[model samples]
Target: MAEKYCVENLAVSVLDNLRYQHDWTELQILTHSPVDDLPLPRPLISGLPPRRLYLHPDDQIEMLKSHPNPEGSIPETPVTEWVLPVHLAEKWTLKAFASVFDSMPPENSASPHRVKRVLLATVHDDSTVVYYFMHDGIVKPRQN
Candidate 1:
């Protein structure tokens, strides 16, 4: 019971940071998995970032082909992302992450090529949150 409360508090802190500090919009706390209707290991956050967090290699190529001049013309569409909040001291394994990935709905139902990924929000004791992208499988590295 107490542990659950702690986890919830951590999630709220991360959400607050994302909204106030990072300027994320349309944030939501998900208690149940949208895909399977099952309770999650911990609450998750979904929100639209201020800018696109990642662009798939294929997407970049397509954009270049369409635009021809890849200067400032490429549209930056912010997509909603799933966030898994955890304390820095917590232990996590591949199976744990796989469970969370399996529970998530597609990033965009209309786009069949999008990959399954999550933003791992790890909160430190000092109330600082760090984010890392976690893909379900190996993804092609984005071109520099």
Candidate 2:
């Protein structure tokens, strides 16, 4: 069966709630195409945040390594995640999700080429996890 709606529209559909419920001033439509290069047909979106939303974990480690503190206790930085608002009723599939992922720039701006943020969306119920892959300058995964 053909999907009724695309990912970009689904994202905006949720954004409508962000506008009305949170009363966030200055909501802006960012992009509608996939953040990178996949096939979903909704607009990808972003707003110039009231404040920066998330921080990547690897970036935190790098920062801690760089800090000149004598103790070097490894200051905690929040695992980077985008703070996007989403609803429970709406349905999404992989194709739709790929669109969103394709739109984002892999590396973030904080460390020039060391930082990156991936979208971490939650349903209104706050139970299910929908993860997307994001990269900044190719990182080696830690061995368990």
Candidate 3:
């Protein structure tokens, strides 16, 4: 149907932007939820960012404690993240987001305690894509 085509187009656009514009690697479009093998509301993009997008405050503290010079000595490994693609015009709600979160694949074993989050990639009419971080629950604000 037309709706499915539109959704696929949006997802491809977002994926292209992330791969070509943002330098993300290991990108793929996921149609089914890895958790239950059920179809997702929309396609999701999974990829590893060029750099670490977020670091938990506790993790940062631990890293500092372990490293003598925390400035550039600590290596920041980029973790694979789930990306939900949508049109800027689509209506979004908490329940909708919760469904997406509940269907997500488990996080990488390297950081089992890390919070579940997604990059909400919203594509505008003008071919621009904006990304925002959406956490499943409230996360402590990053320390400056």
- The superposed Cα distance between candidate 2 and the true structure at residue 140, in angstroms, equals 10
| Candidate 2 local lDDT, residue 18 | 46
* Tens digits of per-residue lDDT for model 2, 58-87: 655666668899365544433333334334
Name the candidate that leads on TM-score. Answer: 1
What TM value does model 1 have?
A: 0.87
Best by lDDT: 1
Per-residue error for 117 in candidate 2, Å, reads: 4.8
Q: Give lDDT tens digits, candidate 1, residues 14-85.
A: 999999999999998998877668897778999989999987787888888798676766888888888889
What stretches of model 2 exceed 4 Å from their correct place? 1-26, 31-40, 70-87, 105-144
lDDT of 3 by residue, 1-144 (tens): 124238888889988999999999999999997656899877899999999987767677788788877566568789887889988788788998988887777775465343378999988889988889898888787665
lDDT of each: 0.83, 0.46, 0.82
Q: Which of the two candidates, 1 or 2, achieves a greater lDDT against the reference?
A: 1
Candidate 1 clashing pairs, residues 3+ apart or interchain: none
TM-score, cand. 2 vs. native: 0.44
Q: Against the true structure, candidate 1 has what lDDT?
A: 0.83
> Higher-lDDT candidate among 2 and 3?
3
Q: Sort every candidate by lDDT, greatest first.
A: 1, 3, 2
